[model samples]
Target: MVFEAILYIAVLLISAKLLGELLYRINQPRIIGNVLAGIIVGPALFFLVQPIDAIELFISIGVFFLFFLIGLEEIDLPGLVRVMRGRIFAGSLAGFFIPFFAASFFGLSLDMNFIQAFAIGSVIGASSLGVAAKVLTDLGKLRSTIGLEIFTVTAIIEFIAIILTSVLIQINTSDAPNVSEFLWLFAKMGIFFAVAGLLAVFALPKVFRIIHSHLRAQQVYFGLVIGVILLVAYFAEISGIHGAIGALLLGIAVSRMNREEYLEISKNVNAVGYGIFIPMFFAGIGLHFTTKFVEIDLWIIAGFIGIIVGVKFIGSYIAVKIAKMRPATTVAYGVMSKGAVDLALMLSLLQVNMLDDSLFSLLVLGTLITMIISSVELQRKLKKIVQVKVGSVEIGMLPIFFRRTVSDKRAQDAMSIDFQKTKPNVSVKNFLNSDIDPKEETMVIDDDGRLIGIVSKKELNNVHKKSRDVALISDIMEKKFHTVIPQDYIFSVIQKMNSHHFEMIPVIEPGFSGKIVGIVSSKTLLNLLAETKPPNPSTKS
Candidate 1:
């Protein structure tokens, strides 16, 4: 059995990696590739893999780490809280409920029972954070205001979905719903969250302090971090919530603490999480998927897919339009991308026999379709400028005259690699002592040459003379700054510089290495626009 499990893993990983790369080349989310990998190897195709106990365990671990990493890296708890009350909250509600009810009613129309209908609703209602994050990152909007709105809405929607799922699980597993049992379930859930909150507020910080002060070994720290996450996950399951929720909670908690330490630990977590577990979890989706769409009525399948896609798009469109966010269609497509949390829920239901083979296949198929459509549509809309509203400022449409000139160009064409840079460990005093002019900016880089932040001679001169000797570049550097990659369109770079009033933007290497490859100045981009400026009517050709 152990050898069989090993063989199954090897086959799945190899297939996932190969197919994932193939899909990536075509600009589709790797998740589609991962799922395809599973289908190819599982009973749907070659039958090289099966849902075994060991594989299931690994998938569960994958789900845990996936959410954990998301909370650790993608979410900003404070930011989420702040946005939860405004138009953002209203938009999130609309995005979540419209698909939920529409999917539920669609299931009821098929004569599915209440529980089954609710299951369908729950599955379709949830948005995939993983999918949306990937799409936003690809568009280079992950750090933008619109990106924040999408993530906040996605997080809220998923949280609601999880709550509904827990209720569904209890109802499905229990012997007829008793009031006392229902109350007990809610009580357990409330108690679990309260305890988790207490730990976050009072206990975890102290524990982290001790870990940092006494444990210098990265290996030891990594081990303890894993142990804590696993413990929380177990507690969550026992408390009738969900293991992934616990992992997410712990991740968010640790993220709220010291950032430098969090970054170090998050780096290691990503290595282990993505390296082994996350892919298996996604592949597990394919293990359950069967090419049995022909079994279901064609009309029913059509309605299922249509309602999931159409309702989500329309719902998000309405919400964003009402909220005054422009390019509502783009945000709509973003929320339409589904995977991760929803798939995790479907897998859980399937394991417990609450979700059947046909329904699981239908839901999974619909989800994969949405992911593909979402990626393509969002990319297209973002690539074309029909005006975008960021915060209070509205960026008008790209002029027809410059569309051909600027849209086709990339940041690397105009960036200067000769820009000044400084090591993060250098003292501000020493850096200021160099020949750099007071007004000149310097990019700060780490030992690996990854861009960390930006600093200026002027800012360093303002530092108290006594402390300037002790303060490092990392201490004084401005951490919040925009960046672009070499492949980023020049128009987008210009738009960002205009919107944020930035004089220069750092160009990082591709693949998120954050290594400074070059810098694009506002002056250079202005020149590009000037050269393309049409001759005035008064001037002779």
Candidate 2:
């Protein structure tokens, strides 16, 4: 079993890597590679590539790990709250409520019992954090304010979804309820929060200190963390809550532990999740699709999907607009990207046999369609919300055409390095570790190795298309970058950053540029202006 599982993962990984690299060239998220692969192997369309149970187990592990990373990478709590409290917050609510209520209503219309209708709504109401995050990542806007806002809202909504899922599952039972006693559910929540609190207040510092002090058996520490996840999950299951809730609690508990360590763990977890567990989860979903949509009345399934998505989109759009979010257009459109939550809820329902195969497939289909459309809309229109301005500005002024250039110096006097200042094949990993202050723009020289252009943080972030995979100095270094000659004067750069509001400006020689060599940054310029005494008039004028 283990061997088969290992082989299955190995194949998927290799395949994902190849396709991922290919898609990456076109600026697509790597997750797309994995998800598309899952769909291809899924029973819905392709029944030939049957993944075994062992493979399914791997996929489950992947899902847990993926969420673990999300918890690790979640937004600043305060920032998240602020964004959620505003228009984005309103949009999230509208998105959740509209779909939820409408789905419930539709289920009832389909002659499903009241309990079933409510369950259906709950499942449809959940949003897809994975899909949303991946879309932003692929667009290279995950770090932007708008992306941050989206990710934050989706996370909070998921938390609510978890609680609702609990309520849906546990409370739906007959008044007596058979599994664990009623109090167990409440107790588990209490225990989780208590443990999470204690871990934050005391355990976290102590554990990190021990790990740092010992510096040995780092792997053992990771092992312990995994154990913590499993244990919490086990106890939660025993106590009547789903294992995923335990996973969340456990993630929260470890949230503040060493960031680097957490990132490392996330990498491993993602491999497992993307390569195995989560894929099986999605594939398992695919396996159950036995032409249910075709068998059922087209109007019934289509109508249900249409109404739920429409309400969500409309409600979110209106809420955002009311709250003064200018960029987000059309509520239904904004809120339509609800994939992860819905999928998770549906999968959970399937696990318990609450939703049969055909219904499950329909939900999957609806989610995929909505997700793709949302991504397209956001990328095309809504993405510009956060980047309202590119350069600095004074309320009213001549916008500066910011440029970079080398100081006006003789060839011999030019600031030069002993080592060849040519582009280096430095590793991306090295960039993370090295003091290559991305904010400090530097010009790249040509073969004669003369100054070409400058590179800025903003420039680095803009390389979505794969002109170069190596981050090779030559490939990525902006040799054709803008600049200001040293003789250009202060007002020129100010106008540039002010009107254009550039982060850094390359200072160069007037018409003498070979390669950019100097920078006049906005911060530095502001400081210089503040510190420098105004030049005395030549004739004491």
Candidate 3:
């Protein structure tokens, strides 16, 4: 058994990586590859592996880590609170209810009982926040207004789905519905959240501070984080909620405190989750695929797929349109990209025997199809609509116009020539007294005219007031900063500038000379935007 487990893991990892790379090359989400890896290795194909107890345990841990990492990366509590408004709430309701009831009614037509149908409907109703986030992040729209609205809607949907799922689980376990059981489930859930919230607000901060101060080893610190995640998960399960919810809550809690430290530690967490565990969890789903669904009607399967895809798209479109949100098409597409929560719910139902293997496989197939279609479609559509321009170069249709702009317009085209340059040896007082624009950042150069560092006006102002003695420009200038070459694409440069929050970036000439050419600032970008018109709908490619 031990040897077999090793072989299973080896095959799973290799297949996952190979398929993931293949999908990535084809411009699809690598998650599709991970799921395909499971189907290839499991009973649907070779039957080379089985979902044994040990393997299942590893898969469960993988799922916990997957949700934990998602919460860490995606959920911005303060931001979400700030963005919550009537349109988002209305849009979320429309997105959630439309598919949910449509799927439920379709399940009933297929002769499923109330509990079974509702369970399946809940799975279909749940959207994949992770998938939508990935799509938005790849397209550089994660921070945009439409992106934030999508995120807000999905976060609310996931929370609602969790509550519905707990109800479903309770219904599945009981022989008949009882008032006490329903009340107890809700009570337990409420109590768990209240306690978790208190710990998050009051205790977790001090605990995390102590851990960071006392622990020197990265491994030990990471372990502590995982321990907290698992402990919360355990409490959540005992309190009759899903463990994934607990993990997500813990992630949000950690996110709210000490952002700088969390950012550093998140690298290690992402490495562990994506590098090993998350892929395994996805692959594990594919492993359960079976070819023994001959008794299940083909029409039922087709109808399920159609309903899942149709309702989500139309519902989101109508909702956003009625709410009068701008860029309605893009918002709809963003909402249509569902995440892994639906799959998680389906698996839960399967585990409890609320859903049969045949039905589970059908739902999984629907999910895989929608995920692939939505991701590809969203990527293609976003390229056509998202317009970014600098100077005379149009970057509205990226990758398509990428090469044209690269050859026609360089970083030098967008760079501001009217900027101050100074030697590192100059005193802060002397530099401030010189006739230079105080609003712009001062570039520090070596004796050879090569760009070395930069000092913002704010830093200079603080130094001027605090320092009893004179300080060199080198003493205050930031040494580590991003620099673009003159030959680089204007679009790529803009992306870097936006991501790093750099108001202005230094553009250096390529080759051994490495001389500072000029700088590109937000003012330059805004000028480009003013000159460029929106893409014409008739001319959209």
Q: lDDT of each structure?
A: 0.78, 0.57, 0.75
Off by over 4 Å in 1: 386-541
For model 1 the local lDDT of residue 386 reads: 41
Quick one: best lDDT, which candidate? 1
lDDT of 1 by residue, 1-541 (tens): 8999999999998888788889989888888898899999999999999989888888999988987886787666787678777887788788788888998998899888888788778878888778778877887877665676667777777777867876787677777878898898889878887889789757987887788789878689788888888889998987777788788878878887777878887988888887788888889889889877769999989988897778877877776765655446777777666877788888878877877888789888888888888888877776764443322333323365367557667898878877777888888788878776544554545557888887666677789999988998888788887888989998788767666544678898888677888888755564454355433569764
Candidate 2, 528: how far from true, in Å? 33
Give candidates' CA RMSD values in order: 13.0, 16.5, 11.0
lDDT per residue for candidate 2 within 393-442, as digits (tens), equals 11111111111111222222222232123344543334434666443443
Deviation in angstroms for 530 in model 1?
25
Model 2 reaches what TM-score against the true structure? 0.64
* Poorest lDDT segment (10 consecutive residues) of candidate 1: 388-397
Question: What TM-score goes with each of the models?
Answer: 0.72, 0.64, 0.71
153 Cα displacement, candidate 3 (Å): 2.5
Model 2, backbone clash pairs (residues 3+ apart or across chains), number: 41
Per-residue CA lDDT of model 3 for 1-541, tens digit only, reads 8999988888887888889889878877788898899899888898877888766887788878877776777666676666467676767777778888998898888788888888877778777777777777887877765666677777776766756876788667877778888788778778887899789767987887888789898688779877888898888877778788788777777777676877865887788888988788878888887766656777876788887788878876876765555456666777777657777777778878888788888788888888887887777777675455432232233343444454456677777877878898888888778888756654545557788887777788788454614788888888887788877876677777766534778888777776887888766754544344444559855
Which pairs in model 1 have colliding backbones?
A: none
Off by over 4 Å in 3: 78-85, 388-541
lDDT, residue 511, model 1? 86
Worst 10 residues of 2 by lDDT: 393-402
